[model samples]
Target: MDNLVKKVKEGIWSGRTDHLENKESFRYHQIVELAQLDTLDTEGKACVIIGFESDEGVRRNKGQIGAAKAPNELRSELAKLPWHVSSEKYVVDIGTIDCTGNDLEKAQQQLGDVVNQVLTKKMTPIILGGGHETAYGHYLGVRNYIGKAAKLGIINIDAHFDLRPYDEQPSSGTMFRQILEQDENSSYFVLGIQRYGNTQALFDKADELGVIYICEEDMHGEQLVQVNKAIEEFFQNNDFIMLTLCTDVLNAAFAPGVSASSPFGLSPNTVRSIIRIVSSNEKTLSFDISEVNPLLDENNRTVKLGAYLVNEAITSFLN
Candidate 1:
């Protein structure tokens, strides 16, 4: 586990110090425990934070290459938020799975191993990702924890279907396709799909695979009622749910620091509502936030927004 994960640095959690002895004034940095994978132990409900430090998948998919730096950047932003979780619940940071050179597959497998360990201990894993490819490893861990017989429903909030073929190699765009083709117990439901973001062939592939999707345009105004109904139905059908958020699913104006920017993507409020709805569910196993490219951000706007969204998930899970 040590070889697979590099422990988080203490400095990354530093922030405003306000009454460290008082729980009422505590912030995330003041309460987050740093632990090692081999020695992790918790007596109460806990959420473990793990980072995937690689953009190899994005690079392979012919996208930008700077998402590798997102994990720590997000950590820095998250350190300052107010900690509102119950006293019985805890949050721990166990560090990251580093992808050296071009060994993306190995890194992803390492992430899966760590995630499996976290879940085995009865803790929720809040994964900060290198790319959308992080979903494959996230899925692997959840599937392993639950075994092969349980039905796993994946809820992706993204603008693209990401159903591209991976004949030669697996990339960020090929994760869902790989899962659907190989895992019969798994099902997929995507929200905020942009009509112009994906090619016609991809749409045909989604149809052939029997994917459940809602267009981005149909998710606004009063149309959300029908969307919520579909979400509820999806939850009822699957035995377990795993939620993944691709930062690019948000409008580029609000989230410019992603590998694939969506000009007509969902608003932050809408995305937050979905995160709350999904993460708070008793059957949802874990959550991952991917594709936040700090290198492309303007004045740390996107990173801050990503941190807030992650906080929303943590609060929902812990409450």
Candidate 2:
């Protein structure tokens, strides 16, 4: 626990520093700080940001590795975003659970611990991820907080099912499968699954696990109504809902910085709409965005999209 909270130093060029008119015109860098999670009082309502800095999951999965550095990049970009919900909700920056020495499992365990703590405090936990593997850690925390019997609904916006078998060990591609295997009561839903991105074995695994998914091609072209209905039904049935987004689910044109870029994945607007839908539902417990590789990004497009999505989701929840 002592090593869990790594303080967030103000990033370079944090918010536009030149503005002086409203004095009240605010930005995230101005409000965010490294704070002790358990010590803060949100009165049962706050948004807690936690960073998951581990690429061992990616390495194990045999993907790119620079995503371990994504937490800080995400923070730097997020720091400049404008915030207008100070009165409605308090956004707490609870440092980061860095995978020091590249220890993925320990970092994940710590992430679960902090998430459980934040939930106990009755606050929402939003995780900035190192890779798709962050989903398992995020789920571990949610499960610890809510318990195994709770009906948990998982929504993944991605190009692939990420349900690959982890016979040897879990990776960025196997976390969802791990969750389902561990918890029978949990239900999983995925949007924007590219047909070409997944193999027959993965699709078979998803079907065997009873995972619900909409292919990228079907997510549009008159199938949108069914998509909305599916999401609504899932929300209604679950006791708590968790949303995880992997940037690789987006087309390379929009999200080229992911470990595995998609040639034809969902658009940002489509992804944002799904987030808003789930977020508006009060049962949505937590959200995490993953697989954003800033090292490979095009002018920080993936990072900025991530920041934009986070902003939109938080704004939706606050309102």
Candidate 3:
């Protein structure tokens, strides 16, 4: 273990490779370096990527367990990104957070540790995922740092609202519900939600809770400008914002490796556009991208797209 940790450290700081390459078993290894809690700017701000591998809820679906390997797959692709983009320095001190044996309690605690450290230094935390159920953990990190009374909020870009009732036990689908229930003033705006998969029960809960829901069909033909406007409105009153990108938000053609592959959703271009608009705003406190099941991926397409999203996050931050 000592020798392995030494070797991993050497590779991360070696600077020969533009990015670090990783895999499922090796994926968590990359995260150990990421969780070092260092690498912040003089102002103590940095972007942290926490990639988790637990898929407890997805165990029921054979295809979903494969998503556990996504973060490792994404590392390889992200390393190849060009350094010089439009003269702004894309200096992301990337790292990962290890998942805790699919234990939600331990996982959230670990997540809270990294998130608290980042926020304490005033750095942004860009979390990758174990599952969207991590929203609860991620939000705990935010609310812990900013305090719940500060009007904390989240922005989800995906095909489902994920507001299933607490009785069902939280999955990727029930994270948003758990988040909103944390506080009534805690606002959550979900974009690109497909009208189909969401049960009437979920919709009713959203309506009663006053969670903002934007259907994919309604936004399908609309310009990126229109979508950005709505996002801006939802975020206008919030003090701290957590951004979530569920791969299912990308049209199946672009992101087919997800557990819940849906027919209709935003094009990669639209996803890019939304990411740019939301991330560029200084209000963003932390972010996460979830549900890229590399096992189901074709030619590593989903990993490449996940890498692309990281690039967009850096570019958006710098711009």
Instruction: Summing lDDT over every window of 10 consecutive residues in candidate 3, give the lowest-scoring window.
Output: 1-10
Q: What would the per-residue lDDT of candidate 2 be over residues 1-319, giving only the tens digit for each residue? A: 5368787665632768545454358777765645787677867357888888888888988898878778778878887887777554667888878877757778788888998888888888889988888888898899999987889999999888888888988888888898899899999999998888889999999999999998999887578889999999888889999999998888799888988997788888888889999887899988998999988898999998988888777777767
- Better model by lDDT: candidate 2 vs candidate 3: 2
Best by TM-score: 1
Higher-ranked by lDDT: 1 or 2 = 1
State TM-scores per candidate: 0.99, 0.95, 0.84
Which prediction has more favorable TM-score, 1 or 3?
1
Clashing pairs in 2: 159-249
| Shift of residue 266 alpha carbon in model 1, Å | 0.6
lDDT tens digits by residue: candidate 3, 86-191: 3223244345455546566566666676677667877677766656665667788888898757887688888888776657455666777777776866898888
| TM-score of model number 2 | 0.95
For all candidates in order, the CA lDDT equals: 0.93, 0.84, 0.68
Ranking by TM-score: 1, 2, 3
Tens digits of per-residue lDDT for model 1 on 1-319?
7678898876999899889689989999988999998888867999999999989999999999888899999999999999998788989999999889998888888888988999999999999998998999999999999999999999999998999999999999999999999999999999999999999999999999989999999999899889989999999999999999999999999999998897898999999999999999999989999999999999999999999999999999999
**What's the distance in Å from true for residue 236, model 3?**
1.7
